[model samples]
Target: MTSRGPIVGRGRSVSRRTFLASAGVTVAAAAGMRGGPLAHAADAVPPQLTVAVIGDGRTGVWASLRAGAGGRNLEQDLGTRIIWQPGFTASLPVMEAVKAGAVDFTFATATAVVNAVPARVPIVPLAAYPLPADEVDFLVQANSAIRTAADLKGKKIAHQNGTTGTYSLIKYLESAGLRLSDVQAVSLSGADAFTAFAQGSIDGWIHWQPATALALTKLGDKARLLSDVKTYDYAFYVARGEVAVNYPQVLAKFMKIIRETQAYIFAHPAESVALWASQGGFPPNGTEQAVYEKLVRDARLSESTAVALKPVDEAAAASTQDLADNFHALGVLPNKVDVRSFLLGAQFDAAKQAVALALGA
Candidate 1:
């Protein structure tokens, strides 16, 4: 049943009732013949693992495609199906899923994980994609007279409250010698942020690609790149630490498929862009192409799965730490927690190694 390579789109259906019934029969048969506790424990292991995913944006779409593709490969390699649960909004919701035992794996940002760790949710990083600073942009209506970062003072701006968008805005404002208090922060998701910017409800919008590109196109001549926050790592894949430990082989196969897909993307940028566009439901008028080029040129996809905490990553970690610290100083985080210990873990290193080896890096 070995697959030739990773599958690259939405997964086929395997009804839960059917899968559970089969699993019950297999477990019963294994238990009847088991010779020891270890054997019994092995016999009790589930036949499939469930992974939760957020909505159908680029990240979610890519994740779903890779997981489905990878799961097929893994089923051949490990004799099991990887179930997926889709339609999540943010990492916080993913964290909620992990906490409730509804999902075994998902992706999130380092900062979000840090915020979650101190709450004792037990998650760990699986892999990282280092996004260079210029990959994310702060944008305003192109026709607006807001020429510099300083001009944002007293202006309303839209941003997702607890995401890279927020941090990017904070850093952009601070660098311009302005505090968040200097500008009105209008909290909005990437989608809503785009809408707000278009309606002129917000003078500026800070967001990542796809959404940024979409907004710019929607605004036509009304949108312009304000500041590119060239100092953040956009996102990372993560799993509940215990789930990863309990299912190393499953995680390994998943990483292998992701590595393959990443290689495919690098080798076939145009095709990859098309795939992203299709998955994300973007229009074919070159919007996806524009965003893909901007991101591909600036974002560094790992060539190897060596999730070593690179200096830049560490610096990003420190910057996030600083953000948390500032939040505490400003009474944002309810109670202060050790930001370092809250986010640091070894799962990323293991996942990195698995991906690197799979890709022959």
Candidate 2:
């Protein structure tokens, strides 16, 4: 493996010699794409795997960094270069990428995977990352009269449409005995939701870290956390079915690298926060650090690869089915499809075990 230490920065310098060598090829041979073992190997190697990512602030940052950093580590471990794709903005776009065969892997909330699978694009969950429900804060201006969930009745709540935030908002409100019909739902992106909340256009907004922390800091005493989705474990790493099947070993190597990085992050929290902030282009105001700490504090990074596909996993599957049923009931999906088939099967389990072994779990 090439011995250059972790390359930092968005545009770090990398020589062709280093690239070829890291990819396990002779420099002269790789340069010529014909009539040689190097040429055949290069041709056989799949094009850089394109991983879709959501552009929703912190999760987006995490997805990009993890994939890039993890890919780099795997490149060194496997002596093969891995291509990292620029992430997309929303689950819809990511799903589109999967359908178009542009994205080979992705990390997103289970809710996103649920919705994508029915479209006939197989998405398999590899591992779970536990996110404390309180991490996602539902807020309103403190001076506003919306002091209780009851107060939100007939009021507008801003959230990203078709996201975990949207589901959590509905679930929380319903738990308070307020139905969707009782409150007005304002659909907006995370950034837009922040703006709407700031402009007094929306009574409440549901948001995840970094943005949640930023809103609290900016709105100060004016904004207060009204409700937190207390049991929400929102995200998971996933890969397209074709990629998972054809490159199981490669995928296993990828997951092993992620597990290692997660351990590194936990062991070196300060350094991890700094690296995340620097790579994510967060300003040096320490707000990013605060948010990173908050996420890391409540988050349980998976050390083992055979993640339990339990109630939450089932709920995620059910949620997707419910969404599809609702959409079909509302004339969305053209035909009824068995969404469960798209989930990870036995092969995935084998791959997980392989990764676990690699990680020394």
Candidate 3:
């Protein structure tokens, strides 16, 4: 279970029910027989642990990482069985589910974490990785009159509601000394926004990820990126505060495994692209590979000096506060809330130690 090594499971299966049922013995009998049938039966099955995931329309990379250890099953090489519960499609729902105790853990952007605070989601950042700002951008159709952020004034722009993309769009406007009211803002899902832009229904589009890649590549000469926003965004690994308290060891192991996968992605960018394309219903092409590479490179995982379950330092606290302040200033939130109060510092410390011991860090 070393981070630098491959995790290959033993492929062993045992039934706890059958073992317990067959080990018919009274407490006195078991006490007398230290290495008897009961003791042997207890070693047969590994413990199973479950966590929730919000698949981002593509790339179940988290699940894929677990499967790479052996097969695409719940069992892991760390002597734990991982049962993945995936369904919530976006960050907001993931936060809500965590708060409601529907799932133990999930992932989201730092922006989503900021928004979650006022929504009363009781979740905290366990770990974090940065994403290149270029993953999101303000785009205009080719041959359009819009050439810069300033040109967006009074133009119809499409962005998803309650997403980090909205924040990106607002930042783009702010850079141009414009506010949301300076232009006609249209709220639409990424899919719908793409269609609207393609059909000339909206003047421009604001979004991230494969959506941005799709628009730029699929549209070919028809889509022009007006600006890129890599410096202001983040990707976060988050979990319920309660889960961190109750299962700090589990969180530690989980973070270690994920860090291993993140390493794999950096090592094999082209192959990672193919895997994500297959999972997300895209063709394996050079365009797709390039997109995935930039997204992964922007993460700078290979360049990160952070350990698993990194504590929230002043810089981390400031990042969350910036998101909160930006959102509030833009009227996305009613008021700016102090995000550090929700951070689980002690829990992260325990998880970090657990990972170091379990993985021989």
CA lDDT scores, all candidates in order:
0.57, 0.56, 0.61
Residue-by-residue lDDT tens digits, candidate 2, 1-361:
1122321212354443443333234445443433332322211334456656455323323443454543444455644555556546666677667666677777666456656655555555555554445556788888888776778888989877666666666667767887666788877887899999989989898866556777788788878887545434345666665444335456666666665665555555555666666665465447766766555654522221113322124455454556555444433345664544433333244334545455555
**Model 1 lDDT tens row, 1-361:** 0111221212343332222222122323323333321132112334676777666535423543553432335455545666777778767778877866677777676557656756666565555555445545788777788877789999998877766677677778777898777888877888888767778888888876556765676677877886545446445666665444334445655665555555555555556566556565456547656665455544433222223322114554565577676556544467776655334423234333444454444
Give the best candidate by TM-score.
Answer: 3
What TM-score fits each model?
0.73, 0.72, 0.75
User: What pairs collide in candidate 1?
Assistant: 7-69, 54-88, 133-230, 133-231, 141-222, 142-222, 142-223, 305-352, 305-356
> In terms of lDDT, which candidate is stronger, 2 or 3?
3
- lDDT over C-alpha atoms for residue 71 of model 1: 38
In model 1, the runs with Cα more than 4 Å from the true position are 1-46, 57-74, 77-79, 276-280, 283-319, 345-361
RMSD (Cα, Å) for all candidates, in order, is: 9.8, 10.8, 10.7
Model 2 misplacement above 4 A: 1-47, 56-72, 231-234, 298-341, 344-361
Deviation of model 3 at 144, angstroms: 1.8
lDDT assessment of candidate 2:
0.56
The alpha-carbon deviation from the true structure for residue 14 of candidate 3, after best TM-score superposition, in angstroms, is 40
- Candidate 2: count the clashes: 1
Q: Rank the models by TM-score, top first.
A: 3, 1, 2
